[model samples]
Target: MEEVAVVTLEPWHPWPLVFPAIVLATGAVMTFTGHLRERRWVRDIGMVLVVGGGLAGLALLGLLSGSWDQAQRAEALVGLGYEQPTFSGGDGIVGGAPGVIDFHAQRDGELVVGRLVPLGDAQWQVVEGFRDSQPKDSGT
Candidate 1:
C-alpha cells in the first residue's frame, strides 16, 4: 500500500454566466419580433445588442475562467492545512505566476507568512522558509 495526499478543488459558480445568456435570448427575441413587424430600426438595435452582448459575454468568460483556475489552486493549498490560503498575484484579472499561493501558519507559537507552489498529483511544496509577519523593530 502507498500513502499519498489528495486535495480536492472547489467548484466554480455558474450563476454569473446566466445574465449573459439572458441578454442573448432577449436580443434574439427582439430581432425576431422586429423583423416580423418590418421595423428596420428595431432590428438594427437588436443586432447591436446581440453583437455587444456576445463580445462582452466572451470577455467575461475569459476573466472568470482565470479566476476559477486560481480559486481552485487556492483551495488545494487550503486542503493542505494552510490557514487563509489565498490566490496572490496582480489584480484579480491579471497577475504574476499561475500558482502563487500566500498563506498563514503558526510556527514556534507565532503567526508567520508562507508561500506554496503546486507540484501536481495533489501535492504542493512550501517555498523556502516562513517569514515573521511582525516588523523587525517590534520586540515580542
Candidate 2:
C-alpha cells in the first residue's frame, strides 16, 4: 500500500472529544467520592465541574459540527468551477437564514453572486446569480 501525506489541521477537523469525556468522568468520580465522604463543598464543586464540562462538550460539538458544515458548503461552492470563492457575512458559521449563505466568486473574469442552500446530505443548490453579465461596479 502507498502512504499518503495528511494535513493535521483543517476547518472541518473535529475537536478532541476525549478531553471533555475525561473531565465529565473525573467530575462524576469526584461527586461520588464527595457524597460518600459526606463533604458538601466537595460535592458541590464536583457538581459544578460536571456541569461545566458538559456545557463545554456541548459547545465543542456544536462548533465542530458548524465548522464541518461550512467547510462542506465551501467545497461545494468551489466545485461549481468558480475561483477564489468568498462567502459574504461570516465564515465557519452559517449566517442569515438556516441552510443559506451568500457567496461570490469569479469565472472567466465575471463575478458571480449567489446563495448556497443545502439540499440535505452533502448536496447543495446554487440559487440566484451566475449570469453572463459584466463585473459588478465597485461603487468607487
Q: Best candidate, TM-score-wise?
A: 2
Each model's number of backbone clashes? Answer: 1, 0
lDDT tens digits by residue: candidate 1, 27-60? 8888988999999888888888788778878988
Model 2, 3-118: lDDT tens per residue?
11111213345557678878888889889999999998888888988998899899999887776765765666566566777776522334543555667787677877766555
When summed lDDT is taken over every stretch of 10 residues in candidate 2, the lowest stretch is 1-10
Query: Which pairs of residues have clashing backbones in candidate 2?
Result: none
User: Would you list the C-alpha lDDT of every candidate in the order shown?
Assistant: 0.61, 0.65
Q: Over all chains combined, what TM-score does candidate 1 have?
A: 0.52
Q: Which candidate achieves the best lDDT against the true structure?
A: 2
What are the TM-scores, per candidate, against the unseen true structure? 0.52, 0.60
